[model samples]
Target: MRIFVPGDAAAIALGADDVAQAIQNAAARRGLPVEIVRNGSRGMVWLEPLVEAETPAGRIAYGPVEPAAVSGLFEAGFFEGGAHPLRIGRPEDHPFLKRQTRLAFARCGITDPLSLDDYRAHGGLKGLERALAIGPAATVEEVVNSGLRGRGGAGFPTGIKWRTVAETKAQQKYIVCNADEGDSGTFADRMMMEGDPFCLIEGMAIAGIATGATKGYIYIRSEYPHAVAAMREAVRRARKAGFLGERLPGSTHSFDMEVRVGAGAYVCGEETALLDSLEGKRGQVRAKPPLPAHVGLFGKPTVINNVISLASVPFILAEGGAAYRDFGMGRSRGTMPIQLAGNIKHGGLFETAFGITLGELVDDIGGGTASGRPVKAVQVGGPLGAYFPRALFGTPFDYEAFAAADGLIGHGGIVVFDDTVNMLEQARFAFEFCAFESCGKCTPCRIGSKRGAETIDKIRGGIDPGANLALVQELCETMKFGSLCALGGFTPYPVLSAIRHFPEDFGTAAHLAAAE
Candidate 1:
């Protein structure tokens, strides 16, 4: 009998370790032969500690399992796919999992993350193999043909960036993977690293070939210890298997990579700021004229991309770029790994083609608010992302579409808020977050964020409510246009969106109380 339990950090936090032990003990007690496979999460977070039993029909799942329930599960004939109170049937058929158009996350949750054999079994390294066979120019052409834009908030074309670095002349070209996922409603980067570290490694290798970059670095956030550890192990195994290191299996090209942990600063998520942090300096946003492709990382031409963007490379090379380009709507081509978070009932990772409306994500897939209250606002992107009122729920999940609605699909993190939430408090929190996390390199961000917080406090305290609202708007505009990095530039998104969509929540204390 085969039993699968997640080793993903989110699952571990929810008592998956104890549950795995329980399943092992129970099987031993019953004298039944069993093989327990520790796999990555399927991204169905709410149903974590989801134990799957392999049977002839398919993999049967039981969710949110506890150690105490192991004996009951076994007695219910869980091994033979017998019915149980916790059984969720095939997890794929569940609405949350079935609705996704998983491309980047295809191998996630389905395989033992550390197992190279399992990765190969699930069609891993196929892209790298293809890239090796086709050579660098054609490999780059494949990515360029694919309509993959940067998944790291910027939405820049990945192929274009790679082409720039590829065309640049440098003695030492670098490929840097930005894994410092510091956004409030984001965990896709950490989850991807922990779930399928090899896919990232493979993607980086492909990038090296495309850009003539022999060295690569994955700058992950310090908070993701599990991801760091998993990536380290994956790199060790890949090197041993000849899938990485000095030379390729069937080609003359050579590439190498290592994992570098960040100081957990939000600004480090920016590509240039990340370059500074990677160089053992304080993390601060750099001016853009040079663009990382021309001059970056110790004054060498470099290729920088987010975790998701690089991970998508393997798929593009393996299946051809046109296949991916055909998935999404308009300019937002290919799939997006939209993360459902906050007050949503079925909050998890939903990888679907771009163009799905915000309403479908919140109401249909998320199944509405977890509190059963009406959803008041949905924040797309991270904390710096704009808040969407129910009236704009029809907004499509595309870069241009969100931008048209005065929003952004930055990193595809959707944080839902219920009716009980006060938008004013949320707006205040946005400024407060910016002040705390800001790198303090620029005046507008350093001073403006503090002033923004104080202004919001004044409005809340009933000090010239009318004037304060206008003052806050003025401050938001300054930060929006003058701030050095996104930390301050995008801070206005939440602040302005709150005031525009939910005016009742702002102003004097009496007004707030009346709204409540």
Candidate 2:
């Protein structure tokens, strides 16, 4: 019998390793034959360390499994899909899994990340194969038709970025995958890298082919050691299997790639900053007169895309652009792997077509706050994303829709908060984060973030509340329009949103009452 246990970092942190070992020991004591396979997470984080037993019916899941319960699980016949209190039935049949429209993450959590055979069995390499057959120009055109935008905060069209790189004249072109996902409450990039390394590899290979680039690099964050290791091993396996390095099988173009780890710097998540860090320089944003596409890595044309943007390419290539395009609402045409985190009860990754309402995600999908209190606010995007109160919960999860509502779908990370949350403090945290993570290149970000935090503290302390609030607002506008990168420009999002939606939290309600 084959048993599956997640090797995902989240699962590991939840004691999946111990559970796997316990299962092995239990099987050994029982004299039962069991082949344990460490696979990627199925995106159901609340049920992590979710163990699955292969049976005639399919993969039966038992989740949040502890090592101490392994003997009981064995006694209860868990290996043969026997009845157990921990049993969650088939993973895919779970309400959380059943609802998702997983495209890029289809093979994640389902396959052994290191097994090329496992990847191939689940429709891997098909996109690269199609790309190889169709050639670069058509490959570029296919992505253009797909209407996929970058999933790493920026809503820039992935096709337009690729077309720029493809059309540029350069002796040495490059494809750079931005794996430096530094946004708060975002883990999709890490999950994808650890769960389905080959999918990323295949995606990057497709990108290299599409952009006429012979070399690619995945700039992963150092915090994701598991992801970095998994990707490195996957790259070795892919290279040996002829999927990378020199000419790919059945293709004339030669493409190769390597994984590089970055120091823990939030600024590096920016495209230009990432390119700088990749070039052995301090992670600082570059001015945008010449975008990365025109003169990128090593002064050559480059295609720098977010992890999800590139990962989605394999599906687009294998299934055709229109097929992927058929999923989402206007402009936001495709699936977004929305991450539910913070005070949510059913916290996990939910990949679905765009247009799902914020209320549906926060209430129906996320199962409300874990604290069982009314959700006060939900921060969509990342730390820089706007803090949306229950009033704006009607907003759709689309690029234009979120922007229209004075928010952004930055990295698709939704952090829920109960009524106990202090919006003033949350806004303060955003400024502090920007201040601490700023690259110190520009005055607005370097000076404004620190000032913003100080001003928020003054409001919290009831020091000239009205004037301080106005000062904070002015500081935000300066940072928004004057900052060099998103570190400062986007810092105002959470702060202004908090002041706008939760004025009471800033001690303004009592003052207004007194004045009246």
The most accurate candidate by TM-score is 2
Q: Provide TM-scores for the models.
A: 0.98, 0.98
lDDT, model 2, position 125 = 94
Q: Once model 1 is optimally superposed onto the true structure by TM-score, how far is the C-alpha of residue 253 displaced, in angstroms?
A: 0.9
TM value for model 1: 0.98
Model 2, residue pairs in steric clash: 40-109
Query: How large an RMSD does model 1 have?
Result: 2.2
Model 2: per-residue Cα lDDT over 1-516, one tens digit each:
999999999999999999999999989988998899999999999999999999999999998899998999988988779999999999999999999999999999899999999999999999999999999999999999999999998989998999999999888999999999988789999999999999988988998998899999999999999999999999999999999999899889889998999999999999999999999999999999699999899888999998999999999999999999999999999999999999999999999999999999999999999999999999999989999999998999999999998899999999999999998899999999999999999999999999999988888888988888889889999999999988899999999898888878888643473355
> lDDT of each model, Cα atoms only?
0.92, 0.93
Worst 10 residues of 1 by lDDT: 507-516
What are the clashing pairs of model 1?
Answer: none
Identify the runs in model 1 with alpha carbons over 4 angstroms from their true place: 508-516
